[model samples]
Target: MARRPKLFEAAPGSPAETRCQLCERAVRHTSRHHLVPREEGGRYGPTVDLCQPCHSSVHLLLTNKELARRYHTVEDLQRAEELQKYLHWIRRSRVERITNRRRRR
Candidate 1:
């Protein structure tokens, strides 16, 4: 049997161009962060790269009782279209921030 390739290797090229989904910072040492908890059948497809700080922040959000309470099951997270929308929104926002920073330089 063959070992599975690392996500970065599987999707080769430069991650710096990929952009962090949370802060829109250049993704250095990028790692896939699942928007929905993986335990709830959230696979890699629903993943996005996030910088360390943003990644930590995401986990923090999940830790919140209110959010956790709202999402009682993996189906709840998956079925909630707003969650997907929010992920896209965060990615776009980050991209905008990155573009703005580039303009400032």
Candidate 2:
């Protein structure tokens, strides 16, 4: 099977840091999330730079079809009840990056 290309790749000498559009935090690495997924015939629309945790939470909480149908914007995503809860809790996190490791609390 062919490997999928990365969603967003930095230019040769682009800035190293970028702000996460969701939680308003600084992140060294970001993932690109399409508001309308390619599978849903959404080619061009809004996309956001999200930190790993935010990106994971989105997929965990909503289906791609749901994202394309209802939450197709950053504001829409922020308004999601589950996403709001995650964002609220994440706000107090001192860690810059959130990984797949399960937290004790």
Candidate 3:
């Protein structure tokens, strides 16, 4: 049988832990999300920490071009209709990590 991915313990207030910018959930691990696509010339630009699921959802819902042109800031990303729905759903869960199923074009 395949093993499950490990979940970080739900220890509130750990110094190393941070909140997901999108879902606003406190999680142990966070991946940096480039405000603009690196290929679109934001290699040295701003970034925000997001949980894996939230980060993956952003890429899944919006194209790199869209991210580079429109959703380049956390405030902009938060206002996106596509992401607003996802944020609402994910915020209800206490689990720090959730599985993301990528959609094929």
Candidate 4:
């Protein structure tokens, strides 16, 4: 068995600083998003580290197919007009955490 490298580890003498790749904000909490989902045959691709609000917003706003097909890169996500507006609001709001409400089916 192989071990996965730590993605959030800081240098020996420094504290770990996690930042949202899309919103470009320094966050104390973050979630890792695979650019292409593992279920979508993205076994080994890029991962975007995002704050909770950004991470939740991605899933809330886009489907997995969309994530895999279109918003699969940091640049792709940042350039989205819809997300740009959302990012602006979140930045002004200065929220550090977000809780996703259960979707009604």
Candidate RMSDs in order: 12.4, 8.2, 2.1, 8.0
Query: What TM-score, computed on C-alpha atoms, does each candidate reach?
Result: 0.41, 0.72, 0.84, 0.76
Q: Sort every candidate by lDDT, greatest first.
A: 3, 4, 2, 1
Computed on alpha carbons, the lDDT of every model, listed in order, comes to: 0.48, 0.76, 0.86, 0.76
**lDDT by residue for model 1 over 1-105, one digit each (tens)?**
997533332233664455555555454455776655565555553566665544554454454343345654435543444456555555444222122212121
Q: Write the per-residue lDDT of candidate 3 for residues 1-105, one digit (tens) a residue.
A: 998666665567777668888888888889999999899999999999999889989999999999999999999999999888888888887666556457787
Q: Write the per-residue lDDT of candidate 2 for residues 1-105, one digit (tens) a residue.
A: 997443443444468757789887666677888989878867776689988888888887787889899988899988988688889987666445556744333
Clash counts for the predictions, in order: 0, 0, 0, 0
- Model 1 misplaced regions, further than 4 Å: 1-18, 64-105
- Which regions in candidate 3 have their CA more than 4 angstroms from the true location? 1-11
Off by over 4 Å in 4: 1-16
The candidate maximizing lDDT is 3
The candidate with the higher TM-score, 1 or 4, is 4
lDDT of 4 by residue, 1-105 (tens): 997533343344455666678887666677888998888877788897888889888877877788898988989988876687888887666577667533445
